[model samples]
Target chain A: MKYINHEELLKMEPQYRVQVINSLSGFKSANLIGTRDENNINNLAIFSSVFHLGASPALVGFISRPDSVDRHTLRNIQQIGQFTINQVNADFWQAAHQTSARYSDGECEFKQTGLTPHFIDNSDAPFVKESQLKYALKLNEIVPIRLNNTLLVIGEITDILCDKAAIKADGYIDIESLNTVMVSGLDSYHTSKRLSRLSYAKPGILPTKISLDGKS
Target chain B: MKYINHEELLKMEPQYRVQVINSLSGFKSANLIGTRDENNINNLAIFSSVFHLGASPALVGFISRPDSVDRHTLRNIQQIGQFTINQVNADFWQAAHQTSARYSDGECEFKQTGLTPHFIDNSDAPFVKESQLKYALKLNEIVPIRLNNTLLVIGEITDILCDKAAIKADGYIDIESLNTVMVSGLDSYHTSKRLSRLSYAKPGILPTKISLDGKS
Candidate 1:
């Protein structure tokens, strides 16, 4: 086993520290955040930090570095009050990954990466047409993490588009069957194989593998 | 494809909405958070909401619903200001998931789930002995998301313990090689297969596959 103390971690090469620290959190969601400015220029950026915040209001949150390449995304979300979170799948993950590249101001990642941007329901933000599972969100809040000057961009899920076959009888979406990929560290992409969906946990009762149809 | 608008989502059965909304975030890290009260009572809980907040200063954040079964974990961290995040692996993911069972107050999840807690370096928190990669952290800040009444508990990495061979030359840990599992929705667990590690993205230049050793 290797043990790295805080001091050693701080002193390691900067890039190395980033990879190590980022990977420490384990696997992350792979999603392309789509947005558009008032000028109607579309923007797309791949984000691995997207997380489920709550379900009652159907909130989603993703970390945004205001000073990073994501500034356009953060800016557009603020300007338009709408954006899309599209899952990065196995088929177009390369193009999805390419969206992270630092594009020039006003440049459209959808155009640069050849991913089609589709609009629906008078929404201001564009959606990646290739994404198998995607959703539209209305900007709800931008809470700053003062420690690092990063913003926690929270949004309310207002709409969703997914393959009907993926939604099970009990509401579990079989994302693995849709080929939605995951990410780790700064660059690695992966696909998953379901191990099991155990039954609702309760004390003194061991959880048994539950099928997607709600059968245990 | 099926479309679910905001109204339809709001009208969903609460449990069904929870499952559907939770799965929309794509895959999530599966982790066992270990904490201990001032009286030395250990607490273990499964958390899939953990996310990477920042790389510099080595920050990690996880959402905690103040009213949920995770109150034990939140209370323990408040009392001790230290906690450990352990990566759930395929070998013991079922045991890890079992930690989420709501035991009565002061009941140690470690004992309830039969998962051993290992302590080191005078730390108040315990590390799961079964975890292949784990790290100790110091509580930095607790930011409340007033929108949902959930708290984002931020912590700084203080120490790390992992298998020596998993750390690649460029510092990206091969977590898949360690068999670390991922979670989706609430109960489903997954193991990953590497697709590819792409090179750093650059505008107008396509990203190519990079090897574990950092060679493209």
Candidate 2:
């Protein structure tokens, strides 16, 4: 086994530390967040920090890097109060990854990456057409982390669009069927195979694997 | 494609809605958070909301359910300011998942779930012996999300222990090598296969897949 203490971690090279610390948390959800500026110039960026915030209000949140430089996604969400989250699948993982590159404020990552800007039923934000699962969100709140200067942007799920076949009776969307990619750290991509979906856990009961056919 | 609007989503059954909305963001990291109360009573809980907050200071954050209920994890962190996050592997995921059950205060989930509590360097918190990757964190800050009533507890990484074989030369941990299982929604566990690790993305350079042999 290997061990790294706080002092040693702090002394590590900046980029090396970033890669280590980011990957330390394990796998992260990979998604492309799309927004449009006031002039409607579309912007897309890949974010792995997106996490489920709540369910009743269908809320989701993602951390935005420190606002030291221009952040088109945060600016657009603030201005329009709307954005879209598209799952990064194998088909567009590279293009989606490319969105992370520092592009100018006015530039459209969709055009640069060759991924289509998809408009779904008057959504103010664009969705990745290549994405099998996508949804639109309206900004609900922005909480600032004073420790790091990063903003945790919470949003209410406004609309969800997905292939009907991917949804199970219990509402689990089969991500593996969609080839949705999961990321470790900042650069590694992975495709997962569902090991099992266990039944709701209880105190003394051993969980039984739920069948993929939506039956116990 | 199937589309679910906000109104329809709001009207769905509560548990069903939770399942749907939780899985909507895609796969999430599965980890067991271990903490000890003032009485030295160990508490362990499964958390999927943990996300990387920053890398420079090695910070991580996870959402805690509204404080309306007694949260041992939050209370313990507030009291001791230290906790351990152990990655849930396929071997102990069920035991890890069982920690989610509503347990009375002072009851040790580590004992109840049949997971061993291993201490290292006289750390205050326990780490799951079955976990291949585990780390300790010191509570840094807790930011409350007013919109959702959830608290984002941020912690600075202090010490990390992992199998030497799991880390790559570039600092990315090979989660697949460790067989760390990812979770979807609330219960489904998954094992991932590396699709490819691409080099750092730049403006126009095509990403080349980096070799796993610790070389470019």
The lDDT values for all models are 0.93, 0.87
Residues A151-187 of candidate 2: C-alpha lDDT, one tens digit per residue:
9899999999998998888888888899999999878
Pairs of residues clashing in candidate 2: none
Error of 1 at B132 (Å): 1.0
Q: How many pairs collide in each candidate, listed in order?
A: 0, 0
The sequence of per-residue lDDT tens digits that candidate 1 reaches over residues B1-216 is 899988899999998898899999999999999999878888899999988988788899999999999999999999899999999999999889888888998788888888999988847799999898999999999999999999999999999999999999999999999999999888889999999999999999999999987788
DockQ score of candidate 2? 0.81
lDDT by residue (tens digit), candidate 1, A1-216 = 898887898899999989898888989999999999989899999999999999988999999999999999999999999999999999999999999999988789989999999988847899999998999999999999999999999999999999899998889999999999999999999999999999988999989999977678
Which residue pairs of candidate 1 clash? none
Superposition error at A216 for model 2 (Å): 2.1
Clashes of 2: 0
